[model samples]
Target: MNLETLKQGRNYCKSLTLNDRKILEEMLEDDFYIKFHELFRYMIDEDLKLEQEWFG
Candidate 1:
């Protein structure tokens, strides 16, 4: 959770290819998709709150 690590994760996500995304989409289907989406959404919300608290 430092800036460098977050930047690296962003870079890695940006590097994902179309095939990678398709594979990910296929993997996260149905009930699994709903659960994972919620978890991912929560992570993003928490990250936003942390950034606002620390940087703003």
Candidate 2:
């Protein structure tokens, strides 16, 4: 997720019930970009698709 999606997901998850948040948090951890330092390095394409694993 990008900065916006990360923030939005956090807010959205906050509004969810505990059970839902538990699942959502796990999902986010599995895929969200928690490390900004490695963002550019890990990014696959510069069409700015940071969500993808670097293929470049």
Candidate 3:
């Protein structure tokens, strides 16, 4: 999920019990960006290139 979804989930957790909220918080705390960055770095090292035409 994205940052906005995390924020909304956190707000929703406010009404939950402390233990339940903590469980959800821990589950949501994975560092997704680091994993994504590593994937991008691997692609770059493998000579992957993006073309504007691909987007259009």
Candidate 4:
């Protein structure tokens, strides 16, 4: 997973209106939510690891 892509996705999410965010939150509660959440977390963790390796 590309960190830049993740950052872009996060920026897009942050740009959403309150109602849009609420709708997205509801959608995320569906059956695939756990898998999606896991994948997102993995990507973030991987990105953080890479940043630490590069900067430390």
Candidate 5:
């Protein structure tokens, strides 16, 4: 769980955008690891949805 590292698509402190900040804020304000899982899940899910809608 190296949050400092840049992932393939998202969740990098240095690479985060404005909207990413909002999502991060939402994630950090929740109940610890469960929220962290939800946040990570949401990131992957949204990326999948966008890809499906755009290129499927």
Candidate 6:
């Protein structure tokens, strides 16, 4: 996604209830977090690469 989409996602997450955010944080502490972290990193790297290709 683009920067605007990422910002929207952040806003949506911020809009979540405190308890929901806490639960999400707890979920991120599990083994699945590693997989998700890796996936997110890869996606972000890809997005940056594409942006550079188009703009730079």
lDDT of 5 at 31: 67
RMSD of each: 9.9, 12.3, 16.0, 9.8, 8.8, 10.6
- List ranges where model 1 is wrong by over 4 Å: 1-8, 11-14, 30-56
- Cα lDDT over the full model 4: 0.45
Sorted on lDDT, highest at the top, how do the candidates line up? 4, 5, 6, 1, 3, 2
Worst 10 residues of 4 by lDDT: 47-56
Candidate 3's displacement at residue 3, Å, is: 16
How would you encode candidate 1's per-residue C-alpha lDDT over 5-25 as one tens digit per residue?
A: 444454233333456545445
Model 5 poorest ten-residue lDDT run: 47-56
Instruction: Give the residue spans of candidate 3 off by over 4 A.
Output: 1-14, 31-56
Clash count for each candidate, listed in order shown = 0, 1, 0, 0, 0, 0
lDDT of 5 by residue, 1-56 (tens): 42222234243223345586567556656666563665455554454212222221
TM-score preference between candidates 1 and 6, better one: 6
Decide which is better by TM-score, 1 or 5. 5
Tens digit of lDDT per residue, candidate 4, span 1-56? 34455454542332344564454456457766655655445443443222222331
| Poorest lDDT segment (10 consecutive residues) of candidate 2 | 42-51
- What are the TM-scores, per candidate, against the unseen true structure? 0.31, 0.28, 0.27, 0.35, 0.34, 0.34
| Model 6 misplaced regions, further than 4 Å | 1-14, 38-56
